[model samples]
Target: MNPSSTLSLLRGICAAALLATATSGGPAAAESWPTVPDELFAALGLERDVPANVLYDAVAARFHDQDQGYGKGKFADLWEPIAISRYFDPGLYEGRDNLDFEVQAGECASCHESVTPGWVHSWDNSVHADLDAIRALPEDDSRAYKKEHLAEVEANLRSMGLLAEGQPLATVGCADCHLGVNVKAGNHKTDLRLPDAAACGQCHVRQFSERESERDTITWPQDQWPAGRPSHALSLQANYETAIWAGMTQREVAEGCTMCHTTQATCNQCHTRHEFSAAQARKPEVCSNCHNGVDHNEFENYMLSRHGIIYQANGDKWDWDKPLSEAFASAGYNAPTCQTCHMGLHGQPTHNLVQKVRWGFAPMRSIADNLDHPFFAERRELWVATCSQCHSPSFANAWLDSMDKGTEQGLRVVEQGNAELKAMYDEGILIGQVTNRPAPPKPDEDAPGGFFGLFWTEGNNPTAIEYRNAQMWEQQLMRQFKGLAHANPGGFTYTHGWSELIGSVAIIRDEATRLREFRELQAKVRELENAADR
Candidate 1:
């Protein structure tokens, strides 16, 4: 037979089988569709009146029978185990309904054999297979209970939204993320999968909600985007810990696990292709997609630092593959990636999904100060162990101290400059008519311009002119300090130090104008008095 004819026959057979199964609702149907418990069904917005047996029968037949005609053969196989594990798991069904038992016993093994044959054997080795058995132990039991307790420790994930009424604990499962309610069928269907953001938000509601809230407040300069795209890392939450420490409230961190793990875009946004790989996650460039910005320019800083310079000059002479260890010397490596100091000398347990890492980018007032708690106590030992890979204990301690002293000195200088400006302003040596005494002036004619200067003269008021000049000096000092701390020459000049210096000069100019106005007013008053006396 021709290839086209053969393909046509297969389609017809599949379609006919699906129609028969949907209408007939046979034994296969009964066993294929595991009925959700009343509470679960109600939570999912299914009909409570429909008998569990009937629903089971319909779903089973629709899914399993060859004649029922869903064209997704391999796709169905990939989907079934995840669906079963997510929805019909033993714990979720315990008090709700025993209907799943009948369906699971009679049809599950056989149907799964057809759908995902390899998974039948693999399921025995899976973490999910024994989760319920572990959860059944007494709370004090160390062996089994410890695992359960650890899983529930909450990771302090941020919340995004309230749980739908009757929805299970916001834990993840294959079907929960991928499937949707079949409104027409009044049962779950594999159609219309949730968007990645929404799927992740089901558990990570706090982080998701926080990101939305911060979106407007955290803005990027228009020049940052050469092509008119939004600035990198402008949203803040793109870097998980930075976002939280920067300003996110404690309330935003109380949600479940999904919030920070997922992003507005799909996983592939950073990981590239859909088949996520460990190798891709390990690269520094992957993080640069969002982190190459003014606040957290890890990529740019790393490149300019000694670590990045060496990596650029040398190829793969050092071991990039191994976790940082005593054998992994920086002498040979020359330079390091961001993974060196923050992650580890050679990328240790810092970024492990299963375990938290202690070392982090220390939060700062101006990216120069050290955070109060540099080591998250929960993972402190783990981080110290990673440091042991390169430096001796004394060396590491000394290095940290040096870094702290350097940062503090820079900040002190800036603070001193600010104090000087405040003192100058207080003395009133420089004076001005402060049109807008407390706030910057509005860009309107309410304070009239040259065209209507005489008519609007009354609105202008002489205020503390020297004080404004001091304020400008304080701003410049802040920029200089921030640049010195980060060791970024460009950041110090353009973004921090120089920009503030210019602003201070502008304030001085404004103060000078105010002083001139005061003198002019005094002269005019004297002239008027002399005329009256004459």
Candidate 2:
């Protein structure tokens, strides 16, 4: 068939699907889901009578807007996990239903198995495809719980009207995510959707809820940054909100920020797609993709730490398939991995990564600044308990104290640099402050744009001193505090942390002295010119 013929055929099919959806709304045509629990709808501040499809669409639209109607829709400012705003293509499922889902798996696989064999192979090995095999396991088998979980998921979907009556529970396949409720109206070309976190939440409800809980987690000041910021929950938003990312006309360079910040779009970064292997995600290497760099060298610091050293040497021997809760006792783990520390909370492993986070991964503020605040104090105790799993309570407490001190130390250096630069800018001696230097890009009109100026330069406006100041706070200070947090002493002292900070400070001091002398020379020149005129 020619391209024109194929297009005609797809249009015909889509028209028929829309007619069916519109005309067939009564009891026989449209199926009603079991009544969902009241608390669930109550949480979203919705009446129970609202259809599942309506709620789903509204949630997607929230991300499309400037301010999510958090308090308007719900009594409290509850967060609905969002898709990557740029990737939210509503046209994919504009007018569709899942009536054709029965044939979706076969149709998707028939072509993809040949065109993308690796994807097929990976999915074949994943538990998503082996539902029957998991169900067949003996009652007492170690993996039997997975079968129970699947059943629970099925029940949840059914209650929520996502799984229709008489629709057999099927393995999670391409169409389940991509075509979703729009399977009946979908074609290979225009109808496919990139599944977001909310789409995945349709099945893995608990995990989705946990990930979204980052929004509700305690935030200090309640106003400095958005709630649950500086975390995976708001990572993509942070990228979009960044002045440098928006200011750069070079889109390719700017979009690179999305490579790591896209956690809001899909969970595939950690749980890689096709296979979506939990084992792969459990490893520390998975984190290195985004967590390594000059500013946040978490991966590098962890590698040098004693914990990382043990994982590198003996991790292969350890069982990667087991849950992290079993790491110390049953998984042959002699030391902590990235997941072991960050994901563990309240005595169990969880999908929420920020529950126990105190200082976070950056040098936002030292824990010493708010040690007594309930939010930090409670989590601080949890940290001690987490560490005390391997070491004594006293040892954990002492080490955490040391980390706090290190954080304060790094913060002081950064503060000092900022103060010195601000002084120069105020006194009108800073190089290029008033002249050649252009104001930073929109949303950041501040002169001497510290961090924002790092991305752009014009007429040497963010002079040498400004550059050094941004580096000291943004890059070196981050490394120093993060290094201490990760337990990499060499990382903090030598590699790229405190040692680098000291160097930046020295440069700033030397530059300040020279600038002052240059100003003095200018004054003398002006005085000599006046004498000549007389």
Candidate 3:
């Protein structure tokens, strides 16, 4: 009812839940989840093994306020998908046993050891399976830090009722992620499918959060939210492709491409989970799926590059599945894979693939942002050092420098389109503009004015002239940046990227002039009509 009473109840209920089911065996707070700690459940008089629907009802009744987690976005946003999953089929968990997944997950190896022997063996040797090795490292080591923090992970599971009482720690199992939240009623189904990225995100909080941030910016210039089904574009942090793909073109499935996995920020886009084999992700093919089109044709360019040439000849001999170490790659790796340059397999390897790509968006000042960026230079050098594993420093620096120059040249074109738009606004042709955020969820029809819409900027009541002009820059300039970023400088210059930018800028300027003339004629018509009436 009151603030003090609600806080007191929340406190008391949490204490009871913890006292009733809590164990000292799980990992500590450092590696814990942003999930509801013991207090929320205990305060509500709900058991850890409560049904999904029942839990949802309680959460709806009690957690009415949108809490801004203990940290910033961690707990608040982290809880979003988990809370949203409450409506998942409760019948799926019908009448299941009190099996502990920590032990049960281990048994998955036995069945797989015979049936899917390769998967089991590969997983056995994976870093995920080697928890003991992780535990033995220094506390400061990230793996060691993760090992020491099982208690929080366990608490998160317990709160969700996914991990029941008497279940041991280390709950990595087939069902934990693969299966949706299980009610206590049914046998575990073997035919279950892949976990949604949102579910995987519950545990892998950081990656998912970055994806959410990236997802925020991933959309085509549109006038509406959830743009009607068959909404053909994936949110790739750019709008031009979306405009081109959805706005300009029609599906040619015979062309052998479709927007299949664009719905949510899929983590498995690269990882290809179940096994989540690192070696598989380290190859070039994983990226070719989405990166090969007109926008960023790195895969096709790599096939032509010295790196791709070598891999084509010798890749089959190189061990595709190897541990990530200083000398993991063979001498046969004379050229780079997508992973070789972006991932830096020759030196320090990391999952943060876009670290070197400091600015994903366009108009990188008069120069590339990476040029003067203190943080960016270190990361870029690290990549070049990896390149130096095969290429000499002079060779690597020269190639990279060319890419930087190409990007600057591309930016000049973007500046032109931008300048054109600015001039239009100056002439009072456009009512206003929207450059920063995506256009507001489609304005009500009764609402006034065209919206100035682009991936980068926004404006209201954007006439056809305004819309087409912005589309020109979004498609053209963005292609230039992406092409260079992908090692296809040609794509950035003559063929697709630069040529397109130049063409689009001309189109934008011409259209803006035509629209102004049309508007002026309309004004004259209105003035003449008034005089005739007089």
Q: By the TM-score metric, which is better: model 1 or model 2? A: 2
lDDT of 2 by residue, 468-521 (tens): 888888889888888888899987888777788788878877877888899999
Report the C-alpha lDDT of model 3 over 424-495, residue by residue, as the tens digit: 766666544333223433221211112224322233545555555555454556667666665655657777
Model 2 score (lDDT): 0.68
Total colliding residue pairs, candidate 2: 1
Highest TM-score against the true fold, candidate: 2
Superposing every Cα of model 3 onto the true structure, what RMSD results? 15.0
Error of 3 at 387 (Å): 2.1
Per-model TM values vs. the true structure: 0.37, 0.81, 0.52
RMSD of each: 21.2, 12.4, 15.0
Superior candidate under lDDT, 1 versus 2: 2
Q: What TM-score quantifies how close candidate 2 is to the native fold?
A: 0.81
